[model samples]
Structure formats: C-alpha cells, structure tokens
Target chain A: MAPSDERHRARMARKQEVVAAKVARASRDKGLLLVLTGIGKGKSSSAFGMIARALGHGMKVGVVQFIKGAFSTGEEAFFRRFPEEVDYRVMGEGFTWVTQDRQRDRQAAEAAWETARAMLQNPELGLVVLDELNIVLKHGYLPLERVLADLSRRTAGQHVVVTGRGARPELIELADTVSEVANVKHAFAQGIRAQKGIEF
Target chain B: MAPSDERHRARMARKQEVVAAKVARASRDKGLLLVLTGIGKGKSSSAFGMIARALGHGMKVGVVQFIKGAFSTGEEAFFRRFPEEVDYRVMGEGFTWVTQDRQRDRQAAEAAWETARAMLQNPELGLVVLDELNIVLKHGYLPLERVLADLSRRTAGQHVVVTGRGARPELIELADTVSEVANVKHAFAQGIRAQKGIEF
Candidate 1:
C-alpha cells in the first residue's frame, strides 16, 4: 500500500476507536420526544418519514394533525392506505390565518390533543407524530403546561414527534431531540406556487 | 352569529384577499433543486418523504446514495419495494471514516455520479435524490464543478434533492430551495443509542 493509504488507515483506526467507545457507552434505551420545528419547510415531512421508519420495523404509529386539515396531503393519503399500522387523524379545521376563528381553532386543537393524549398513553404505538402541534401551541390555543404534562405521561418506550413552526421553550426543554429547520431560500419567495406531489 | 364570530369573519375576508393576490401572482412552474443540510438529523429523511410524495403522484424517482451504502436504511427498504417506479443505487463503499481509502472513495463517488447523471437527464423521472452527496463534495472526493455541471444538464421539470451536512456554498446558491436543519438537541448527546426505527 502507498504511504498515504497507510496514513489514512491509521487516522481512521483512531477515529473508529473513539466512535466505538461512544457507541458502547450509549446503552440507555427508552422512548424519545423529538421536536421538528422552525420557519423552514419539511417539519411534518420529517415526522412522516419517521412514520415510514416505524412501519418498516413493523411497529404501529399514530399521527394527529393539529392545523392542516384544510386539504389532503400526499403523506396522509399514503399512510392512510395502511389503516392497520397507522391511526391517522387530521383534526384541524385549517390554518389559523385561513380559519380566522380563534375560538373554533382552539376547539379543534383541544379535540386533536384528546386524540394525541390517548395515543401517547398507548404502549402499543411505537411512535406518535403530532403534526403542526407547534402552530397551535404558538397561537396559545392550548396551554403549554397541559401539553407537556400529557406528553410526560407517554409510555416509557413510545416515541413522540412534534412538528411545526414556533415550538415553545417548554416543549424544547422536554424534548430529547430537537431539529429547527431554517429557511435559507424558499420557492414561494421566488414566485413559484405550491405544486402537487411537491407541496401539499 | 356572535359579535366575535362577525369580527372573525371580517378579519378572514381581508386576509383572504391578500393571500389570494399572492397566490394569483405566483404562477411559475419548473423543476426545483432543493438542498437539505446542516449538522442535524432529518436531511435524508426529508428527501425520502419527497420520494413518497412523488410516488404518490405516480412519478418515477431515482436515488443515488453516495456515502451510506454500508448499512441498510428503512428508506432504502421501503423505496426498493417499488422497483417499477424507483431506480435506486447504493454506490458508495461506506462512510469515509469507515472506508479509509481516498482512491476507492473517489472511484465510488464517480460511479454514483455516472448513474445520477443519467437519471438527471431522464425527463420521465420527476425527482432524483442524491443522499449524502454533500459529504462526498465536502471531502473533495468528486470535483464540485463536475457535479454542478452535470446537475445543470438535468432535464427541465425534473426536481432534485441533495442531502447531507456541509453543503457547498455554490450548490446553495444554485438551489431553488434550501433548508438548514439546525441541531438544537440530539439524543446521542444524552448517551442514547440510535434505535432501529428512530435512527436507521
């Protein structure tokens, strides 16, 4: 082998030792509360990807949409095909700006939370995705304390993914994994309308 | 209706007019180049979700994984099930740290790019995903200029999603949409091992 190959091998061997040690040290196994939030897109999309991952492992999943029931999404259409594996519910009336009724929106959020609470309590569900829950929380439709309390009651091995823009500080504090999708540039800003199969 | 309801209706009417004008003015329809990057999770996962969306529309997709060919991913398993609609290729030997051979890694990246180039030229494919391509570019395994030139040659109306950390500045500039997944918190930091359904 060349001298460069030898040097590369040595460097990798040292890195592997570190990585292996870290992997070995990480032994805890429990359910995680994951938060996907920010101004950028792909929050709910990421949560839906987790749904697919859970389904791949033959684990049941539950999805509750908090503020996107105005129109159908490709994810909802696809996941709904597997009724046995996915307990999907689109409980929101629409976007707050579109609905424009705070009282009605709050009622819708409460109804969605009720379903989410039941899913959180269920041990059989490997993952529960609260799609756009942050928007409702941001609008003050639901009390943060109540939401966090319900989340805390989840089974030990049941994961939850909350997604949307403007996630509360309290939710972030309780989450094991939190990813904020930052928008660098959007197509809409470029005068491109939302397209089917791409955005819905 | 209650007085609050009347006020809500008036507010909605005004908002609708503004939204409608914005929607009406946005009419551009063309293929988009989307980049998902940052030192955070869900970059590849979001791309997979888009694959699902494309499949839902009965559109063909092509996927070339540049640096994650060693382990089996849930996305690979799920997307492979639809061989008729997806042309999926895992071209890399493994992660750079694991492979530890610059020459071999470069060869793999070049081979993957060859496949990706063909897919990009195919107008029938509505979407193409270059998973972990950012890593290959970051390492200079493949010439950035060559990759960009090939991308520019893609057929019109064929969307592409390039995902991984450390996306190049040039790629971001060329992209129609770009999202940076910010790492607010990670389960690995808490000594939590990557679980089958959650991480993989």
Candidate 2:
C-alpha cells in the first residue's frame, strides 16, 4: 500500500474504535417522532420518503395531507397505488392563503386531525405522516396543545412524521429528530415556475 | 355567507390575483441542478423522493451512490425493482471514514464520476441523483471544477440532484435550488441506534 494509504488506514482504525463504542452504547429501540420544518422546500417530500422506507420494510403507512388538497401531488398519486398498504387522505380544502375562509379552514384542519388521531391510535401502522400539519398549526386552525396531546398518545413503535414550515416549539421539543431546511436559493425566486413533477 | 366569510373572499381574491400574476411571469422551463446539504438527515431521502416523483410522471431516472456501498439501502432495493426505469449503481467502496484508503477512495470516486458523466449526457433521463457526491467532493476525491463543468453540460431538460453534507460553495452557486438541512435534534444524539430501512 502507498504511504498515504497506510496513514489513512491508521487514522481510520482509531476512528472506527470510537464509532463502534458509540454504536454499541446506542441500543434503544422505539418509535420516533420526526419533524421537518423551515422555509425551504422538501419537508413533505422527505416525509413521503420515510413512508417509502417503511413500506419497503413491508410495514403499513398512513398519510394525511393537512393543507395541500387544492391539487393532486406526485407523491399522493404514486403512493396511492399501494391501497392495501397505504391509507392516504388529502383532507385539506386548500392552503389558508388560497382557501381564505378561516371557519372552513378550521373545520378542514379538525377533520384532518381526527383522521391523523385515528392513525396514531392504530397499532398496525409502522409510520404515519401528517404532511403540512405545521402550516395548519401555524395558522391556528387547530389548537397546538390538542395536537401535541394526540401526538404524545400515539401507539408504541408507531413512528410519526410531521412536516411543513414554521413547526411549533412544543412539537420540535417532543420530536426525536428535527430537520430545518434552510433555503439557500430557489428556482421560484429566480423567475422559474413550479414544474409538474418536481414541485408537486 | 357570514361577514367574516365575505372579508375572507375579498382577501383571497386579491391574493389569487397577485399569485397568478407572479406565476404567469415566471415562465422559464429548464432542467434544475438541486443541492441538498448540511449536517442533518434527509438530504438523500429527499432526492429519492424526487426520483419517486419523476417515476410517477413516467420519466426515466438514474441514481449513482458515491459513498454508501458499505451496505444495501432501502432506496436501492426499492428503486432497483423498477430496473427499466432506474439505472442504479453503488460505485463507492464505502465512506472515506470507513474505507480509510485515500488512494482507493479517489479511484472509486473517479470511476463513479465516469458513470455519472455518461448518465448526464443521456437526454432520455429526466432525473439523475448523485447520492453523497458532496461527501466525495468534500474529501477531495473528485475535482469540484471538473464536476461543475460536466454538470453544466447536462441536457436541457434533465434534472440532477446532488446530496450530502459540506457541499462546495461553487456548486451551491451553480445550483438552481439549494436546501441546507439543519440538525435540530437527532435520535443518535440520544443514544438510539440507527434502525434498518430508516437509516440504511
């Protein structure tokens, strides 16, 4: 082996020892609550990715769309193909900025939350995704405390993913994993329209 | 209608007008270079989500794994099922931290880049995902300028997604969309092992 390779090997051997120690210590097994939030895109997309992951493991998944019912999305179209494994629902009338009616939006959010609560209670589900739930909570369409209460009461070993911009502090605190997607640059900001498959 | 409903209608009507005008003005149609980076999870997951999106549209996709050859991933297993649609290759020997041999790692990255370059040249591919390319770039296994040059030469309507932490500044500047996934809380930080299907 080259001298550089020998040096690298020695360095990695030490690093592996440390990583192995940490890995050995990490033995917990339980359901995780993951939050994907912030102004950048890919929040709901990542949640759908987890749904895919869960499904790949031959586990059932439930998906509830809280605020993107105005149009059909690529994820919904694709995941819905697995009707037996995926309980998918587009429960929102539309985004608040689009629907505009506060009462209507609140009612829709409540209905969506009811469906989400049902999924959380279902022990058969391995993963439950509440897509854009943060936006509903942000708009105060559903009480944050009530949402938190329901989330906290989810069945054991049932992972849940809540995604959207402006995630509440309580949700963030309760989540096992929280990822904030920061926007460095966006096509829309550069006068590019949202494409069919990409944006949806 | 209620008085509040009337006010909401007026507000949304105005908002719609503004949104429609903006949408109409933003008419550019071209392939996008998206970079997902930072010290958080879901970068590659989000890219896989896009692969799902592209597949939903009956579009062809290519996926190249640069630094995750140590084990099989849920994404590889899932996407590879549709062999007709996805051209998947796990080109890396493993992560640099794991493989340790800098020379070997550099050879693997170069080989991966050659495969990636071929895919980028193919106009029929609607989306191409370079999984963990940023990590390869970060370790100096591949020249950033060469990668950038090849990326610039991609077909007009072929979208590309490059994911991993420590994305180079030059690549970030060239990307049409850039998202930095910020780590707020992680399960591993709390001594929880990476679960199969979720972390693979």
DockQ of all candidate complexes: 0.61, 0.62
Tell me the spans in candidate 1 whose CA falls farther than 4 Å from its real position: A1-6, B1-15
Candidate 2 lDDT, A9-119, residue by residue in tens: 998889888887998988998788989999887777777777767776778989899877555677777887789989999999986668878888989999999999999
Estimate, for each residue in B53-131, the C-alpha lDDT of model 1 and write its tens digit: 7776778989998877445777777667779989989888987778878889889889999999999999889999999
Give the alpha carbon lDDT tens digit for every residue of B73-188 in model 2: 66777777789989999998976768878888899999999999999999989999999999999888999899999999998888899999999999999999999999999998
- CAPRI docking class of candidate 2: medium
Model 1 chain A, poorest ten-residue lDDT window?
Answer: A67-76
| Native-referenced Cα lDDT, model 1 | 0.86
Which docking band does candidate 1 fall into? Answer: medium
After TM-score superposition, the amount by which residue B87's alpha carbon in candidate 2 deviates from its true location, in angstroms, is: 1.5
- lDDT per residue, candidate 1, A1-200, as tens digits? 89987898889878878887988888898799999999987777778778777787778999998877445777777777789989999899987768878789989989999999999989899999998999899889999899999999888799899999999999999999999999999898889987655676
Please state the Cα-based DockQ of model 2 relative to the true two-chain complex. Answer: 0.62
